[model samples]
Target: MNDQDITLSRRRLLGSVGAAGATGLALGGATGALAHSAAQEEAPTALRSVGATAVPFHGRHQAGITTPLQAHAHLAAFDLAPGAGRKEAAALLRRWSRTAGELMEGRPAEDDTAVGRDAGPCSLTVTFGFGRGFFGRTGLRDRMPEALAPLPRFTADALDPDRSDGDLWIQIGADDGLVAFQALRALQQQAGDAARLRWQMTGFNRTPGATAQPMSQRNLMGQVDGTNNPKPSEPDFDERIFVPGDGSPAWMAHGSYAVVRRIRMLLDPWERLPRGQQEKVIGRRKGDGAPLTGGTETTPVDLEKRGKDGTVVIPANAHVRVSAPETNGGAAMLRRSFSYHDGFREDGAPDAGLLFVAWQADPLRGFVPVQRKLDSGDALSAFIRHEASALFAVPGGPGAGEYVGERLLDG
Candidate 1:
């Protein structure tokens, strides 16, 4: 593989964002609303150069972590088959890495199904990671990064073990629906007998160049998400997201940790509340994502502002207030989530919610503290349930002629 394979073009990215608003999905950035319907349109025409855009596969960091959210995604995990270990895992990664590189560049495999043969790259990305048990399964326990610690149980957790973690994880995203599906199917085949599928969740976001400009990335509950997301330009963004070379685990240098959760929104009950009460719950103006205290979307939330009744304008238990970095010792995570709808349930309610994927240098400093705060009293907790959870040590992007995880598996 070429070292130059993974760099994203800044000019191309900017063009995707129209002046008026953003496309529906801009992952790893400010939140925007995802429009869901009774059915997903296969490939709803092309927009600008969406189909021609390509995200390089080889870089210092994995692509999907900071790459803009694609319109469609497939999040799945796999457990190693019996007797599979380091040797087998390495070979699997080799095949996966090669195929991922080709597919991401809009090339197809020999066994390809031709699902997106003419769709071009569509900004596709296929990211790989290792869960806690992955080390033990591969006999690389000693090389495992301590950052893969188990997540503490939260009050709102009603976790289903079957749908949670796995020995390995894969996140596939693309601007085009068919291209995303093609990547998912291609990678699953590459797993071969070395790994068995555990759980899979399909998600979608607003397509690039969808709106006149970029609009809000709204969730199923109809709220603007990602208002306070940390930007790459932030001085401490890389320090907080990617592990430096001086990090403890030698193999994980430049890598980051990921916390994946399937949070189901209680939409029926939430929709019952009037829009005003809903805004009060989140402490933001639903229309523009501005703080209730006033100003635009980027306005600083007034935590100290009080109403006429001497109560804080943003409720003490409001999600925005509770999850604020100031309130949680400056703990922050780059949240790149995709909205999911698994159709209606047997109970006649929609099984729709978010596939929340958060990345940080260390879980202890990023997701843990903030989530702990939310666990205690984030008003949004009332409307969401943590159904599945996982923690993975997503190693840094591979160097030239190397596959993902080459350092750990070969070191």
Candidate 2:
């Protein structure tokens, strides 16, 4: 049949099957239609995957402040097999990258890509960071140096041998809840028989009141969340995010450190509190995320003095008190957090909280110290609990098709 006639027939067939199944029906006839159908069939399943990487864009707070989306973050620990060297790991990673690209572009696999299993909708963005022991080894010695790598200030003392001392992290995002599990499955499959590569996954989501705005907007809790956050798209971001000096390796510079915390919110009890009491605890209004001692949402908080009656306006132990710039001598960390509303608990109640994510040049000096300070019996502790946490050293973008940290790890 002529091209037009074939097209007409295919359209008729597709119409008969309805849009949902039309592609499959059309594939049964014309060669071109068959090819298209195969392509559609090969497309990755609609699954959730994790996305873990350093913050790249400027003005991140704007997106966090404006969006209503919630984020859930989790951390998984893994190790590599003894004989599976870097080359094997690289091969696996390259395959993963290929699959991820296809999935992102809506392509599916014709056969199982890894573990003899077919590709699916869920994919992950896996990023690597070097540890002291990784650089100490001969296989990677020439590639990495202690001075050039991220200090192992955040890792736990009980190290996993099979897993590289180096860090591998993944961030998965989706409109569906299954994405996280799917991404984990993919990672497990890719690891294969190798027991040396150990990993941990920490999940976080945006808060209920979180908007995709910058500083001064209120999140679901009615208190302004990031009023004190550093402004992106400015020269300061360059200085803060990028490591200074020609002495540093080219790959190492321009990257920032990532600190992740899986905080559990006590929503039920938090909601039970009277609105005024809640406002006092958060030091802001719930609807707007504004400060209790308010001006506009973006207005800087006045933590210097007490209220009219001499009682502390913003309580000394409030979250804002610990995280605020004024109280901490202008200490800062880039926060790109999200709220999460996972499925209900066994009791049929929601298990929800914030996926607290932050980035900085120095985790020890920036995030850990700040977190330690905030942990000091703050008013925010009343409604939030830190269930899981981890720190990752994220490299900057790659140049000319090279992935970030490719050279340092000999990938």
Candidate 3:
């Protein structure tokens, strides 16, 4: 399109440039507006700012780990195709990386699906990781981090093997659903003959800018989750959440371990409980997530506090009480979770719950200890079932001109 036509097209696409929800510019009359439009013919197209906010694909670490939770996400795992060894894996990663770089910048890949062509980048991110089976498949087991060890069985687990682990994992997130879906589709196509899809899960959170004020998101059970998530500002945040460069296995220096779980809440039984009973089960206020012991949401829990009846406030078996770091030798995980609903079950009950994704320097110290405690006797466990689980070693981000896992795959 010519300069004049391009400008006019943008103006119309953005609705007269000054109309409500447009560019917010107000060029009063047609004469004045035409003059302004002509002067700005060469100016970049303005189609609202949502799509313009891009997250760079290259960095010291993958984007989704510490990145803010997005509105939409797709978590999928793949197994290397038969006879597809290290060489094939390396080539696949190269193609995947290039496509990811383009998509994250709101640009189309060479074989773009056009699903999100009209939208901006919307803060898209694609994170890659290696599952335990991946190492065996590619004959790189020696390079896999010890932290990727299999999790011990839990009492509350009803895991489905088919939906559990795979050779490769991908996490795609974006503020826009179409953008997220487009990225997922592109990556799947790129896998081609090198890998085959194992399992996939879709999830979502409250949309950014949807709430009048920022707050922790609520799950389908209507409870505020992630109130005590570790922040990057904390003194021990990096030490606790990411692998140290000095640690063994050079390729995983800046990486982290991810514990993926599909926890299904028994909503029928849970919703039957009274509000007061539910609060006791979680040991938090139903409305605002404040500890039953007292004070606001951010206030530290007073485990010592007793009620008028001399019973401990914040019930002994409450979910928060059992999972608290203090109760588990300072164990904690950086939870970046999303709620998922995969329609209804054959029994007609809603099939939904949290796609619990937690990151830590070591799963043994972070997820294992805490989860073991919960499995033993957590009151919340009665209303939730662990349906699927997987652990992955997510290496540091690839440098410029390098694809993810290039070090290990190409070594």
lDDT of 2: 0.49
- Model 3 scores worst on lDDT over the 10 consecutive residues at 20-29
For residue 73, model 3's alpha carbon misses the true position, in angstroms, by 0.5
lDDT comparing candidate 3 with the true structure: 0.84
Candidate 2 residue runs with Cα over 4 Å from true position: 1-77, 101-166, 174-188, 194-224, 244-250, 341-351
Q: lDDT score, residue 144, model 1?
A: 80
Model 2 agreement with the true structure over 1-411: per-residue lDDT tens digits = 786885564344333333322343212223323333344435322121111111111221111221222243334444445566566556654554444343322233223333212222221233344444433332665655333344343222232334223335554443223444444456556656643335444444432224464334334454546656677655676455444434245455556666656566767788788988887776766667667677766666777657889887888776777777566655678776656566688876566666666767666556766665666656777677665555555555455345435645553
Please give the RMSD to the true structure for each candidate, in Å. 7.9, 10.2, 6.6
**TM-score per candidate, in order?**
0.89, 0.64, 0.89
Estimate, for each residue in 215-313, the C-alpha lDDT of model 1 and write its tens digit.
558788888888788889999999889999878797888889999999999899999999999999999998888999999888899899999999999
TM-score of 3: 0.89
Preferred candidate (TM-score higher): 1 or 3:
3
Q: Model 3, residue 391: what's the lDDT?
A: 92
Q: If both were scored by lDDT, which would come out higher, candidate 1 or candidate 2?
A: 1
Which ranking of candidates, highest lDDT first?
A: 3, 1, 2
Model 2 is weakest, by summed lDDT over 10 consecutive residues, at 48-57
